[model samples]
Target chain A: MPTHNRIDATKVGDVTVVTFTDKKILDEAGIQELGAELFSLIERDNRRSIVLNFDNVDFLSSAALGKLITLDRKVKQAQGRLKMCRIKPEILEVFQVTKLNKVFDIRDEQDEAIAAF
Target chain B: MTEQSDADVWRRVIDLPSERGSNREVTDDLLTQLKVFGWPPSDVFAVHLAVEEAIVNAIVHGNKLDPAKRVHVECEVSADRVLVSITDEGPGFDPARVPDCTAEERLEAPGGRGVMLMKSFMTRIEYNAKGNSVVLEKRRT
Candidate 1:
């Protein structure tokens, strides 16, 4: 229920759908804020299923990817599911190059991610 | 980067404190020059990622965010290509020793992906013998 500067969170049935507000998630301060908000969904609110909608993000650095890796572990430790959707092809290349696409549950659309959970 | 030193193109050299957010101004300036020179968005994105990751490595891993230390960045932009070099004032490590972050066992780790990402995105990436400095280059084709 807190006001988040980096993302928008809403509930879809049992899944909490989060949308990134920034086009570029590069700066360290912004990445830290993003990681904190994401961790809070499971650590503070105990939301079990989460979908990160990336339609708005045009660019994201490795640091942002690092935060996602940590967030994925946090979600898994809490017995929750995490999925990411709507990644731009160029941005998706980053995941593929890093082989993180294999690690994350990435779908082509938002509804697919929501339904998967 | 020296190849374009005498050519007519957008160029800049900056020295900044080793800390968070210091790369933004230089990065923004480079992005603008690339845009004006007609580098497509996708190509621009690649340069952006490569540059951001390299500078951050210089500031965080190389300089350790030491206020006494400084990170130097040199950039050049042209219609044909863009080149960037980042150097940090700290005892350097070997780039060859950075573990492959994409390895199966290390996939879950949060860090160590920057170097690999830089290589994948940039056309060519080279580290100094001391590893305290890196040069990232991309040629538009």
Candidate 2:
């Protein structure tokens, strides 16, 4: 298992449950590193059924959302599933305002997200 | 928008290189002021998000990360409101032409959502005709 500075990825019955290492995902350089770390789960590790737990992330910029969008695309191309759980209400509003809630598989809890897979 | 009252004072005005992280100082000041003035966390989040997006757009999209250019940032924060204006030295593009990121076909696209998020979070946003400058405002709620 590769060590990731930007995220903590653990396995829950073959599903990679990932949580961020940053409270605020705003900086461009940091966001790029985060995106790369996430993409690696699918591109390099070839893991399927991923759930991104956003319990600790209190804030994120639109650029971070872009990376998640690209990651979702990559996971789909790899025939893996990507789900997001535990997004803060304020951060969740960002998703709703952008109408990305419809595009993403968002669940209320990590167990729910994992069960959906 | 042209006239400023006694209360409308710009707290910080900076000319920064068009580098990726150059907006940090101004944004840091704005966020700190908001919190120190007792703005709620949710409101702080909105203001912070809008300001970050506008400055990043100025550096990345408008100035194209040209170090030769600069991003002029003017920010004002008071008890009731926060205002920030950012202008880039690039050949300005048309904000109207930016495709709707929410449109069905473009929903999956990664780019082009910054402007929308800025508009959504800021209480009001105004762009100069040349589109190189943007003013983001948020009122205490």
Candidate 2 lDDT over residue span B41-121, tens digit each: 889999888888888888988899988999998878778888888999988888889999999999988888888888888
Each candidate: RMSD to true structure? 2.3, 3.0
- Which regions of candidate 1 fall more than 4 Å away from where they truly are? B1-8
- lDDT score of residue A60 within candidate 2: 94
> What are the DockQ scores of the candidates, in order?
0.88, 0.83
Worst 10 residues of 1 chain B by lDDT: B1-10
The interface root mean square deviation of candidate 1 comes to 0.7
Error of 2 at B51 (Å): 0.9
* Consecutive 10-residue window with the lowest summed lDDT within model 1 chain A: A21-30
Best by lDDT, which number? 1
Q: Please identify model 2 stretches exceeding 4 Å from their true place.
A: B1-10
Give the chain B TM-score achieved by candidate 2.
0.91
